[model samples]
Target: MQIKVSTKYLKTSSKKMQPIVSLIKGKKVEEAINQLKFLPKKGGRFLLKSLESGVANARHNFNLPSQDLIVKEVLIGEGPMLKRWTPKALGSATPFRKRTSHLTIILETKPGIEIKKEIVKKEKVEELPIVEEVKKETKVVKEEKLKKPEEPEISKRVFDVRRVASGRHKQNLDRLRRKEKGGIIGRIFRRKAGDK
Candidate 1:
């Protein structure tokens, strides 16, 4: 069985991904993953994610072992270009494209291998007893809740009104203190050299 996985619109150019893809094509899944883990390129990370996704799909969905899987194909294609402009000297703008790439990896088991799917059989469940237990538990919970007293609801507006009233009173007191210290002209004339 062949498993294919794709990553779309990676923020890199196809040219940047070419070397990484070429290095892993036709290699075993384990070898490709190891090489990708140590590669020092940004594109390597993107390709590695695609390869791992393909390998995981094969192992989990098809019950194929990673050791038996090989990288059959690696494809990198150009994606949409993000157009941007930079300021130029002569009141003109220099336009550029931020390139993107799409990567796809195909993994297949080695030749002479056949996939066998395992079937799981579910046993019959006794649901009537479970339903009766849930009903009894719910009744006990309702009785416990009925025995508790309800809490009184506090009004948030009362606290908010008090806070606002205290703030205004403080502001008025500050204004009166400034007036008692005489007007701005009196305060400035009487001010010490070190005082504002």
Candidate 2:
């Protein structure tokens, strides 16, 4: 199986990224990643990200093993350049282009190896017994519920003053609570905000 992953409009020139590709091309996925890890160039980071993405695609989407995969091709194409002017002497501006690159890495499995997809055999389910058991469980649950009456859940609006407030007031209250909790210091010190 062949898996391709492309990262477009990377903020680096194709000329800068081209040399790094030769080091990884025709190499194993793990070796390529290791080689890229020690590289000092900015292009190496970009290439590493693309290569890892390709490997992940091969493993997750195609169910191919990383040990069996090889980097088949690395295509680096020039992307759109951002034109900017730098202030020069005598009130003149020099126009410069910020070059970008589009990197595409193709990974394929090794030769003479056949990929065997796992076949999941479904067992025929007996429904009559299952239905009877479910009915009996429901009856027991209903009897238990009847013995102990459940308390009513309190509405948030009844207790939380913020919920009762509308629009700008609610937003202000939320902002105040957020500020009181931590503010900028909390935001800066917290590790991985996405985890919450």
Candidate 3:
């Protein structure tokens, strides 16, 4: 196993890279490369470059192919601070402390041993037991109804059946017909011209 570091001091770099570095440590070379390709961190890119260099070193110095590269460990540590000054209110100045980091990557290769071609075992696509997805009828999630002006009480009034049944909507017409007149009770549920 050989450990190598890209930067002696990362004093101005982001500390956010520690978690990602920890995630890839001890992972396979291929997986680490893929993860570092799109990871969204400033130090991650630099750390990836260093890790790749270590991997390359294993390949070239040890006379081994890429498949033999394995990340043994990764180390992250705090680096020297870069002091900065910022303008503050009331014509004063504020001293700002900028943080940096240092990263070390270690890799190892198996020696004097032959490794078979990596047979990528495909994850058995679990045949979902042919789940006959019962075609769910189209569903409409109902939203809240708008607040409308309250109708007059008209508690004692009785409504005529002939006035309500301007049947544009069949369901509304059937509902009005089923609700026969019961004096005040009937008037409370009367249909207007816009009911349909």
Candidate 4:
């Protein structure tokens, strides 16, 4: 696997792009390209273009099919640094660096084959199994939640059962009982004797 990159983009230094390339090297070409395309950095665009160009170069130079090859390694290194000076206050100068990058991308055919693997799309991955897995998880959670039994609600009466005979109603009932008594001791203590 051989790859080449040209140093032309002039803005940010190559030091920034090298680290990012290392992280995705040896990854699937489709995945690497997808990630590079979606990234928001200025250097990402340049690196992506270089990677594509490298792949194209490999296919044409090596007589290999583009689809049969995957990016095996990607490398970016600091190139010759351009020096300049920035104006400072009071007749002073500040040193500035104009950075360049050297990018290398390597592609290889699928192991033991002269063709590249068809890039499996993320969206085409089966979804039915995932939905089923989610449903199973939710069912387990619901069962766990129902494991504890709840107590039934009981309506409590407001009456104080112990103090029923302490008020005016209790006194009236007591008077009626006394008035109805006709035994010897009861008659002696009856209200009819004018003991009211």
Candidate 5:
């Protein structure tokens, strides 16, 4: 399996990045990372970033091990150029082009070995015990509510329809409805209109 990663429009010249690309073009993933780690060049840092991104792509997306992967291709292409003008002698401005590089690294598995397939184990859900506990808790709560002193008939009738709703949901609905009764701006307009 082959995986490719590219970084575009890097703020470095293609010439500067090409040598680093060549240094690890055909090396194994591990060896390439080690080589780039110790290198003193700034280009090496960018190349290493792209290489590690490719390795992670292979491992997570393709289930390939880092040890079995090789740096199949390292292609450096010229990206967009930034144009500026530098003042030269005799009040004349010379055009300057700040070059950018697009670095692409391709990785593939070595031949004769199957890429390992990741096994996705479904989590074991023990629903019976949880359901049993919930039922017991509900029963206890219901008994406690029944043992409390009886409330006024009017208040019971008013709240009978909302008995099943949890308190948090009731509070949220109240907050939303209260906000809908015209916020600060609307209240200000209402005051001006004498419709308080």
Candidate 6:
């Protein structure tokens, strides 16, 4: 089984973090921690903490020995950029973007250790046949009755006219109405020409 952990929105750019994380890729957990401890970059410190967190998670949750664990993968991804403005000469401003990164580390057991497999057993269920009881019927004579007139028709479902008439349909309906009855501007121009 493999253990995975992630740290997001670290205050470091992917360009700066890639080189530091490459140093510990595929190394043993303890060795990686040791290498990160001596590094001068802040990204190394954060990465060390994230690796330790993964080790602790494996040890406490999975009962896996830390000695057999090795770093399998290191993934660094770009996160959201924060945009700001810096003052420039001649009454202008320049845009400044601060970059962020997300890091994920995967760890797995060393080679030659037999992995345990779990077997799932399904139980058989027996179904019994259902038997329904029959009832006896008696016959009787029927009498004729006069029928009344049918009532007015009513629909079973209703649709909203407002929803259908919204958006582009509404705009098209307005355009058609304006075309049928010339328009306010046309009437105004005609009245001015008649007066002239």
Q: Estimate each model's TM-score.
A: 0.67, 0.61, 0.52, 0.49, 0.59, 0.57
Leading candidate by TM-score: 1
Candidate 6 wrong stretches, greater than 4 Å:
114-196
The alpha-carbon RMSD values of the candidates against the true structure, listed in the order shown, are 5.5, 15.0, 20.1, 24.4, 14.1, 11.7
lDDT per residue for candidate 3 within 1-196, as digits (tens), equals 4535455676445457667878787877888888888988777678778877776766655555657777788877788888999999999999988888877777766555553444568897766553334322222222223446699786754375444456434546566666664456655666775542
In candidate 4, stretches whose alpha carbon ends up further than 4 angstroms from where it belongs are: 1-11, 61-65, 115-196
lDDT of each: 0.87, 0.86, 0.68, 0.70, 0.86, 0.84
Residues 1-196 of candidate 5 have per-residue lDDT tens digits of: 7888989988899999877888898889999999999999999888888888988888888777799999999999999999999999999999999999898888988998786677889999776545788889999999998897977676534454445555534655766877898778787666456577
Task: Order the candidate numbers by lDDT, best to worst.
Answer: 1, 2, 5, 6, 4, 3
Superior by lDDT: candidate 4 or candidate 5: 5
Question: Once superposed on the true structure, which residue ranges of model 5 sit more than 4 Å away at CA?
Answer: 118-196
Q: Pick the lDDT winner.
A: 1
Pairs in steric clash, model 4? 68-115, 68-116, 69-116
Q: For candidate 3, report its TM-score.
A: 0.52
The lDDT, on a scale of 0 to 1, for candidate 3 is 0.68
How displaced is residue 148 in candidate 5, in Å?
33
- RMSD (CA, Å), candidate 1 to true, equals 5.5
lDDT by residue for model 4 (86-106), tens: 999999999988888676666
True-vs-predicted CA distance for residue 94, candidate 6, Å: 0.6
Candidate 2, 59-178: lDDT as tens digits: 776677789999999999999999999999999999999999999999889998787777779999877545788889999999998896678997655555555545436656667788
Taking the tens digit of each residue's C-alpha lDDT, what string does model 6 give over 1-196?
7889999999999999999989998998889989999999999988999999999998777677778899999999999999999999999999999999999999998988655555669999889765343211111111222344589899755375535534535645767889787787777677556552
Q: Count the backbone clashes (under 3 Å) in each candidate.
A: 0, 0, 2, 3, 0, 0
